[model samples]
Target: MQTKDHKVLVANRGEIAIRIVQACRKLGLAFTCVYTAEDAASGHVRIARELGGDKSLYRVSSYHDANELMAVADDAGATAVHPGYGFFAEDYRFARRVSQRDRKLIFIGPSWRVIRELGDKINTKRLARSLGVPTVPGSDRPIYDEMEAEKVAQSLFEFQEQQGIRKPLVLVKASAGGGGMGIEEVYDIDLFRSVYRRIRNYALRQFKDEGVLIEQRIRDFNHLEVQVVSDRSGRNPVHFGTRNCSIQSTGLQKRIEIAPGFDPSSIEYGFDAAQVLRDITQHSLAMARKVGYDNVGTWEWIVTRDGRPFLMEVNTRIQVENGVSATIARVRGQKGVDIIAEQIRIGLGEPLGYGQEDITFEGVGIEYRLIAEDPDNRFTPWVGRVDGFGWPERPWLAMHTHVPSDDPYDIPTEFDPNLALAIIWGKDLAEARERGVEFLDTLVLEGANNAGEPLRSNVRFLRDNTGRILKF
Candidate 1:
């Protein structure tokens, strides 16, 4: 009911901010955006005003500062705030501040307490295990000292030996860390203490949390996840099947596709695809409902060699790979499940627009992250102007980008610009792969480097790894 009358504030940067702007227009709502000084000339900022953002309050780029963003919303008379999947999307303090009455703004996300609970790896893992959801074998509590770290390391080594794994690889993770930070992988048991100390120090510096835990690292694992949407009315959660996100060098996701991946060679795990589609998704939704999860979120999992699935973590906001959800919705004969819009509605005290039985997925969607980084040069940031930009001509291709030739922004080596995205939809994984690769070949980002080489890219890497990344 509050869908059209509210003026929403898009609080974040890059593609996600631009995405919220588009959603606002589709819903007949006015919106505002906040960006950083570095993103002053980005497309998201320039186009937001044209889309719906109030031009007067749209120029400022101080995105990470919660107090500043809330103030911006107040000045613009925004009725709600949409923190687009980064910066403070999972920050409880920021959510709490937005929920304040003087602000009178609806925080378009999970409740602050839910964010707080999900932010803690220990608490989330505990919750999952309590709900009978399987999780990776690891320490039951935080490793408070070096002795505990040693004990955990030896236990993992024994597990590796039992499983015939050559190395007992383990990951030390911080309770509050995200984006692959606050984590250290230990290959040798002898080096456990030092690595633990290093991770503890890094966690203290970054997340300010001294809590750390270790889990057995499955070398041959498939990274899968379920997208779940919950409304504030306590309705049963709606789920959009699972996604195959196993292709990765580190934790940085390079490509993602809808269920039923193409080319079995690309997927690394040993699982029955059809059964997993039902089990993992139901497992995720059941676990979330057991805990009364009250907003749209992602439930991540890792599948082992034996086809066993385990809970990894929950992301309490929209993910960059959400295009798969959109494409799947289209296939299921359901419309208006735009996750961001539903998030707003839930915050505004409305029920989810559709029930689980109302939707059915029918196709495959592929999303490839396009960043301005030199893969050959240790993945360093390539900062320069877009000499030439090109893309495929098709109705199903979705490109979310922020770069512009008129007034371009530099890609900093210290941060992840994640400037562009390519999301394509198809009837199946094979067609999606073919179209994806063909479309990728047409993408030409030139004139950035001094050597005149095309924007030191990764399009080829994605094409080459298609069949190589599927579950076995």
Candidate 2:
């Protein structure tokens, strides 16, 4: 049973909010959703209303309106707040402020301290080393100016010499940035200087942090991430296997998302990717025990051609790929969403409805982000109305759209107004890939700006790079 006061205000928009609201309803708790003035009629809002939510909804100007969102949470009698992935997911200050209110404002992931410590690229590398996690070799501290960056670059070169490593490429990253932004791979000194200047400007504009971090880049790398869930006791944290994120730059802002990319035949019967996944999961859970990790998070890593895994960063929240992961689990008679709801219920001192083992992984899933952006136009944000959207018969697919049906968004006559997504699951990876492509083709986006070509490019990019694993 939930506690007497179990109201939850999801401080996010789009499919993320819808997913969380569903969890809230399953727990018999009052659920509230907030939206932007533009997205007031979004699918998230519609789902909340259909699920018996009230008009006490709050509206913000944009996704970054942190203060306004908090006010809405407060006004909605929300005892806990869940900030879904993206937006303020990694904002330590926002988490701290929400907790300061002491109204049981659950950040729903790692503690504010963990976010504050790991959100910085330099500090993250240091933490990885302390945890005995293999990390890319680079500067041990942040490089603030051009002179400092050059000095660090030289030292990195010297270190590579001592280690007998060749062609030591470096990645310049912002101290406070994620989402594949504010990061550039530099192959040489001149390139480092050029990319550093450009990346610094972008980082400054986005995060106001000019401090850059440099790290040796691994070649022929596969981006793999382990999802982790921990409790407040911090005694037992668990890893949820791994996902192959090697589908680099599938256009339209989709950086690459293909999970369980390993061939089943190659994986030994019992001791294969599943074993490594179990170990990683155990390690993550143990780390949470030491640091008091809460809710669900992910550990990102880069697997080099030689099979060495280097820890990259930790995401302390439900990821965009959560729906995909859950869809796959459901096919195997597992309930991933129920597991999440149970986690929240346990945290709130309510009776846990299910155990961890109840949600087991099965099959393969693909999550493709469909946005209304013009890839030819530098992936610029396209805003307007979604005139129409439908899906062909596909049992293993789930669609999440932010647009309202009847009250179509008014497209600006220059861009597609549909920022939606299609998550596909299959008994295995091959079938999932085929269905994903078909789903993208069947996506009938009607708008003034021709977003079809860019979308096609994204689908083709994924289809072409399916078997060839390489870094972006």
Candidate 3:
């Protein structure tokens, strides 16, 4: 199918929405964008008006309202919907509605069946184990009965003991919950029952499903992700590469992401870094093929200090850090690979037109998630008006932000306090680290809240972490 025949409704906000608009334009496809009153001052709104004209922009009540989004898509005459990374991006019900509604707009992610199948942590674990993929040692299915849950916890403790783990820990989490909610860690098996009951109650109240999963809590591991892309066929799935997302905040939210996952050339590891990267990618592709995964998704994995990798969960949408991987990727010796554009093209029924062998990687890419927060004070969100925000432009650097430099922008309190995303590329790890520091050192970000206090950011934290990008 030709991409020009389709029009995309960008059902998202901030930097991702901006990128989706650019991606649609890049493919010669018409695009429309949505914004709420709180987000009217965002750069996405400005770019949509400047590039797509007033007719291409719509005012929506909420990003979470499926009905509002559908109405906007219909009003804009959009043939497809692009849920960029958050909100309805991974909602299977929303995806189903887009395909099953009377208008029948295309969902620009995985099929609803794929999302439904992989969204469940237990189901994903079972699928991985069925295909010989390594997963965290514990129950592959949800344990409802208290006796069975305790047994699983005991086994995990014993398993860790057998592996010479001095302090064994077990993780009890809600099967239907995500984003670090409905989870607890038990250091002693004797206290497992109480924690289990608490989480079960919370799960039942919040998710309406008390089914809980028990797994061994692996600590001191590097969080890695494999980027997979495929067309509607799902028969020719390929991987972009891996990214290291270990540098995170206190809440386990990722802050810095580096492409290629590891750097065996610059840092020595206890295990073969190259072999670990290859193994994880191979396993990720195998599972994608098994589930007939189509479109863009992320396979998250946790690698131990000894090089053992365990499959975590699948993010069945384009990720926030996808740009870092794209920065280092080359498809058929071509530069400037845009994964979002490829996702749109493939979602609209276009064939992949390329294979795994045709893809290549070069250089080191690092992405810093600039946020208006106090990194020293528990990473507290800083809500204030940004008086000044500017950074020196460089050939190897790319910035994606919603904060306009020409005007003082007030940070929205209703959403995450993320300011921008700065992606830097270099020939090697050393060069990338140097460039990252340079970018942060020269950044000019100033703001003040209603209380008349100065703004606080994570600039120092990001700069300090840049020197240890790929170290495990």
Candidate 4:
């Protein structure tokens, strides 16, 4: 068990830090927040510290400065390090260095080995198959070269033919990509060849590697995820329900998200996805135990028309929308961060009040990711200071934002060096929807609208359907 005096350096920025800080406070640990100069005034920095973090760092660049981050953690006298989502959360090398430092840097999630395994889309699928878990119909290995890709494509066609499909729509996917990046769909062999060739170069630049996966494309499919928590002890592996993520816009220039989705019951099969969720959790835990995994994490899946759930990927850290799931589970009084605290306690050989089954979900919760983007101009990313922001007296509303009054309202462009994210949660699907709409209505952005089209579209969609748009 960790002593209450544990000082943890949060090696991340933004709303995720805010969430982690809450857990640390509840567990009675001294938490610190780190940020680049750009994020110095973010809400994450404001909420966690009794006096805010004494130590903050700056790098030459705004994002992905791994070495500088590790150095800051070392300098902070921190007993553990919590890498909130993004940044180096899944970077094996960072975790290895932290572990080697012998400062008891708690990863707050999976081990480097499991991360290494899962980060490789090729190997992850192999592991899934070995565990008798269903994976998307795709190449078992990352395509190495154009020739190899062609060979795999040919074999895929043969397999499709055997399945009575003369032609199959396929997606050329970048193995190391996430958050809907590095994915392309091609309906025919010719299109696949042309798009595959183009995406290969893009993947090389984005992932700094050359490996892609060829998989069948599932159109009009609901993107759902099962949030689960497991410990190093290999006991009480459990599923924490699902989140629907099907309301994304059609193009890159435009970006929007909805929750609860279009029709939750129409996608009732998503509930049946628990088995797949269990398999993913079990497999992920087994992999973690084999490599010493712990803390809270999530397993991502996509349910197809045939009512089969296919493994997509695994997130080694708490997800952005985790608050929503936690709120829903809170109906049974399971606060999201409480799960992490319990898991951390268990991982550290501490005690817990109850078993996993003791936790049950109650009403629905909607979490809308409010970003600094313009809803006009095809949803180009824009950033600026919040001229005014307020939440009206509304039911079931919990707001999280990063902007501070003292900060400048500098307008941001698509390539703005800094960005802000806000998440609002509500109770029950209906209540959550009402709260989200009411909250957005009260949100006012000044300075710039770089991605206005997408932002407006998203707000309008949420206003129209609450969070149910995500239930697709």
Scored by TM-score, the top model is 3
lDDT of 2 by residue, 1-472 (tens): 2453577778777767876787777777787787766666677867876774554466667668877877777777677777777778788988888888755487665678878776665677666667777776776666688988987887776777676777766778886665555677777787778888887887788778787788776666667777666666555565555676765442213444655534444343322544444545555555556566666777777766555567767777778765655565542364444435645565565433344565567777777766665545555556544566566867777777666655555543322333566777767766766777777677666544344432222344444554443222
The model with the greatest lDDT is 3
Each candidate structure's TM-score, on Cα atoms with residue i matched to residue i, is 0.90, 0.84, 0.93, 0.81
Model 2 reaches what TM-score against the true structure? 0.84
lDDT digits (tens) for residues 103-163 of candidate 4? 5576665667767777666777777777777777778767878888877776776667777
lDDT of 3 by residue, 423-459 (tens): 9999999999999999999999998999999999999
The C-alpha stretches of model 1 lying farther than 4 A from their native spots are: 53-61, 139-147, 162-164, 173-176, 200-213, 259-270, 331-337, 405-409, 412-414, 450-454
- Which 10 successive residues of model 3 have the least lDDT summed? 175-184
Model 4 alpha-carbon drift over 4 Å, by segment? 45-50, 53-63, 102-104, 157-167, 251-293, 331-353, 374-379, 383-386, 393-395, 405-408, 411-428, 449-457, 465-472
Task: Mark the 10 consecutive residues where model 1 has the least summed lDDT.
Answer: 260-269
Task: Give the per-residue lDDT digits (tens) of candidate 1, residues 56-86.
Answer: 2455635677778777888888888888887
Assess candidate 1 and give its TM-score to the true structure. Answer: 0.90
* Preferred candidate (TM-score higher): 2 or 4: 2
Model 3: lDDT of residue 296: 95
Off by over 4 Å in 3: 138-155, 172-184, 189-214
lDDT of each: 0.73, 0.65, 0.92, 0.59
